[model samples]
Target: MPKDQKFQKINFDLINNLIIIPIEINGEELTFVLDSGVSKPILFNLSDRDSLQINNVSEVTIRGLGDGEPMKALSSKGNVFKLGKVKNYNQDLYVVLDKEINFSTSLGIPVHGILGYDLFRDFKVEINYAARNIKLHNPDLYKHDPHSKSQTLRLSIERRKAYVEGTVLMENDEDIPVKLLVDTGSSDALWLFREPEKGLEIPEKNYEDYLGRGLSGDIFGKRTKVSGIKIGDFELKDAKAAFPYRESFGFIKNLGDRNGSVGGEILKRFNIIFDYARGQVTFKKNGNFRAPFQYNMAGIELQHNGLRYIAESIAGFNGVVKSEEGSFGNVQILLENKTRLSLVPEIIVSGIRAGSPAAEAGLQAGDVILAVNGKRIHRYKLQEVLKMLNEKEGKRVRVLIERYNKDLLFSFVLKKVF
Candidate 1:
């Protein structure tokens, strides 16, 4: 907790490429995403608000990517946000009043809100993806290692989002200089905005699909692969990218001049150090640095459910075995010592794209996935399962599900539609 210490270590939860951190707000401990793309800390999806003491509350309207209308939120000032022993007073936060969307379910953990640019502005942050830890250093006393092999890139801060210059390989094999936002909050590898001025257009072989879920609603976009993306001396080939329709951007259209965003999918390949105070970001490649980017071809969206167990009556059927009655039950378990229990992750079908493999196979929303390709769902993390579904075209996938207490088997083959 000492301010003069070289760096303060903070443990984090890495779920589906998103960084979730624990912090205290108004003396209450809550989980928040460490997002560099957001300008200020924002709180949302809290069912109970009267319990927290938030000062200077005012109604506000905010717009974000997606098709839904502008969200109605509450703005508050003078709130104490405590990260470890470090406390920031009089901080500003935008609290969403509407509770229709809950990120906790999708993230597989409770996410009270997002902590953004303000945190990086106050300290130098070093994120080790392999170690799942973050080190916070005082800018005045922090010093970069002279013998480190990490590459440092100059950053352009616009509206609190970090942007860097990179080269994108077009269909013609020409490298186009592009300014990309370093967005750790986004799951995709890269997102190129279609701007006429920049001569940016959708790739010839691209499919229209759901990009992601935004604060407002579903974001529809084009999914495609670029020949490569060059960041400094490192070049990543066949990177999966998204191009959200212009209308889906809403108010963000007027924010800045940038070609696209570089998201966690690409950033995860490196151990990143964000030195906002110095206007520089450093990166060192990890073991997954060369892994090829892939998209979900199964066409089913999944959400994680915390530790759960199959009911005693349904214990005999372990997903692989066929059930005579086709009925199964699941029970949520409460553990006094959660650490003693090895967590077995549960996932449910949240959405299915029309005409896609999963949809054609009769997969529907609310189906509890018990297994994928004969492997138990608990054996893999949410991201792993997603990658499996998106693996290779013509690959057969057999999914077992528990729907309304009835067990059902679904099978499909991954295909490239674009």
Candidate 2:
């Protein structure tokens, strides 16, 4: 029999992907994900409380990816957490109470807690999202790359009305200094602002005032192209950004020390060394990291109504022509072309926004949209449907839906906007 391959010893010196660290809450050891996106002290969910013997409870208001009111959380202290060689024998760690902390998935675990900048400020940290490793060092003694120069500058997050000192490159400068979040969970492109005054910018002159979600609540943002950004010795121009005009201040204040985050989008494009033991991150701008893409465009900004992702896309071969249809929501699917997909859910016209297109067509909330142009709505996405509608502007099309579980079909004309 062939010998079994021994699992590599857990490397505390470098944490890539997810690592299980021993944390003692009230003398009981538990595990949590080390996340930068968490924005605060250690947080735990309601499910993990019983096992950890959390005996006390406090009403703490916490925010997340939606517009729901602040969530109440439980808190405690006398907790001991060990990361690699460093140890926090006793500290006050906050625990967030929620049955299922949903929004984004972790490396597989149920995202128990996050260790943010509080602890990181004590050490120099480096994260290589590409290599999947996080290294810590002492900031005072860490070595700087010969090709890189460091300067502490101010960054203003307009929504938060605050600024922080961040280190960036002094070369290939753009008028807008790249504002970043030192987030570890974001595996996407950098978010840029369009209206430098509003501190946001959107391409195609479109703005989604109610579209945004991360560790914060739903945000208003604009979509636009980023020619690129540079920091230290690295530069990523021609990148795309989802410039959100709003966000929660908790995180902004916490990471106000770093200009913005140096996320995977730009990190993957370079070789980085973070000596958190010392408090510095260095990047060598040379690597093959492509930004996340959506149909040649770099991203697909979207909104959700609880059950689905709602958005439009350009249609047909020339990118001309458009239609509107309900793409299945949130659920994943595999397209006929072997591409992976997130199918939109079945949507009947919910409440139509006042004075919107549907309302003018005598379409009201609760109207079911069944089919378009006599063809059964099948295998089409939200963008494709919108494209079809745009292409057939001013033309009448038949729509079918089930209201009160009764199948109803009607005709509506697409109107031209702009």
Candidate 3:
């Protein structure tokens, strides 16, 4: 392929606000989350179904957002990474061996790894989130569009990660300037590190919640909403926010001069551009900008537990023909296809916050979810199931689960916590 001015426009899977992109490693196709906060790509959750080849490996341990211990991983320097026909011949990566750190479960997909800085450093990237496609423009040939309506903002590249400055509305709705890391990896709206001294503190009305998974372990925090967040001329109102417990900060050595991070929950609201070499980011409002912020009303986190096969009966083209009692009567036929087993995803509750609706209703971790609201769990995608739980405050929810060979039912009414 020629060194063209444009890279292939790749469509991505948008799950829980995070961008899941497909790429090739040593000719093996795999899915990865495009994370702007990570400096180097990391590979994990490689199940038996995936095949990959890595060269020049060395043992290493790394840590991130999770509260657990540093994860054991291997570093590899020689590998061919491909996005469509574009190639990076010497991609460096860290491969985690621990099966417990797999993201496929939480993502409800086969997520083999994460891609970050290495992909962004060399090109002008454009993400049309609403349309769900990305474009990589050659820096030398790419020029700012003359008719683009997007407003440009200064982007700070520090420690091989990106940061942007924005204003956060305090309790009284007074806007205060703060620096936030641009984290596309996190599904939460905002993550404010508590700095009361600087006027940034957990909102008084917030509730203790399980924030999300970090590199080192699970992150715990309080969930609340800020009055708004301002970047450029746009100020989003009542933006959801999370204040992760400081103990979970171990994975990241330093918070630096920044207060917290702005995650995909907020970023997905706009079509954006990332110009790493130019030290800038541009944002234009997308259709999702005005969508109301919602939390997991059921207070349950789910993950895929692998797959199970079940027999399914299907209709066949051939039908048995029968004569009617009278010569003029129409003929009747009865036929059916053979029963065959089909593989379906098995989902389970991974975590439930204490005192939340699900917990109050007796939902437990490790329960194999059989159905949600009378619908088979396999019939809906993970996000669709999440939407059902958080459909509305006061909405009643029913769930069926199998535990210890016993099927149990649970019900709860969604409640507004903040």
Candidate 4:
């Protein structure tokens, strides 16, 4: 075998708070989400599985965050995986057979599967979040620059998962030491498990809400802002955090001893270096390090759809539009001969939080959002649209939506209910 490359530069896409990398699986190019929380490489959401060659396949079962039952998957081996200039032979992977979960629409791009610990095990990966690029260095030849201001923290590995010790200041001025899993896959800033025995409880002000969508179903939890979090020599104040209901997180509760997790919302503030081989990680603050952390106050979830439109007559106007929610709608709209239609990407409302500013404005799932604050929806990505909604509390949001082939206008002010 030839010697591996000493260094490899890999460009990546930062979508929906996840690092997406392009990789080759069995000589076929595919997009995979880089997640440090996953122990092994998993292949799922393939458009055509028969085209990919595989060997030694067996059936398996896997469980994730939701209320649904465990999903049926496949365990396969002897597949070549390539990341940038580096390659690994005869790797193992888990393939999910289910096709119900489509991350592309939610992320505004194609995502084939997830790659995790397996990639970090052999290389010292430096992730420059600001530049949207990744550098994989051969561990044997990798060296940390002596003049850099990056802080390094030892990582405790268990079952291929990385964890670090941190201190969280409670509202009562009590500082509690906790073990936090470094999970790049999760978008929340922090997730503190409620442990009454450890004096851990839900913060004074919090809202019962849906944390995120998991493989099984919606993961419900409480969202709050914490006093502060200290990791090594760095400290962040008033960080947004989540506390999942213990009963709702049955699977995560069984995953060893852990107080909480450090997710992408917090990690994005720093340029990170993961040296899994050396059992340590480094952090360097970026431009967004001091940005205030905010949650969605609009109470609506938005998804992306390819550019497509139709014409419908305005003669028969009804308050309701017969179209499927969460799926693409093909409604015919009638336009005059001289009328010009603007072709832009479709942004659909996927979910609505009860009593939210959006919900109060009569926004419902399946509403095709056309604009926000007079700005066209096509001008922004799904995440950017969300940021506009969460920019500030009490900010007025003017929106336009298409329903039943009629353009409707609405406005609301973002407010903090919790």
Clashes of 3: 8
The local distance difference test score of each candidate is 0.80, 0.45, 0.84, 0.80
> How accurate locally is residue 267 in candidate 3, as Cα lDDT from 0 to 100?
94
lDDT of 1 by residue, 347-383 (tens): 8998888888999999999898988888876656666
Candidate 3 residue lDDT tens string, 1-418:
2376455678998999999999999888888999998999999888744467899999997888777888789999989999987788998999988888777778777788889998889778899989999998877778887336679999989989999999999888777899999988888899998888888887888888888886677889889989999988889988899888888987556677988999998999999999999899999999999998978878898877767654545466344443433111223334355554445677788889788999999999999888889987666777777787779999999999999989999999999877
Q: Give the TM-score of candidate 1.
A: 0.86
Clashes of 2: 60
- In model 1, which range of ten residues has the least summed lDDT? 322-331
Best by TM-score: 3
Each model's backbone clash number? 0, 60, 8, 7
Task: Write one digit per residue (lDDT tens) for candidate 2, span 166-247.
Answer: 3232223334554565454444445543344533334453434333344344544544445565564345555544555534
Two-way lDDT contest, 1 vs 2, winner: 1
lDDT value, candidate 3, whole model: 0.84
Q: How well does each candidate superpose onto the true structure, as a TM-score?
A: 0.86, 0.52, 0.91, 0.88
Worst 10 residues of 3 by lDDT: 324-333
**Regions more than 4 Å wrong, model 3:** 146-148, 309-341
Question: Which of candidates 1 and 3 is the stronger one according to TM-score?
Answer: 3
Ordering by TM-score: 3, 4, 1, 2
- List ranges where model 1 is wrong by over 4 Å: 48-50, 146-148, 253-256, 304-310, 313-347, 374-394, 402-406, 415-418
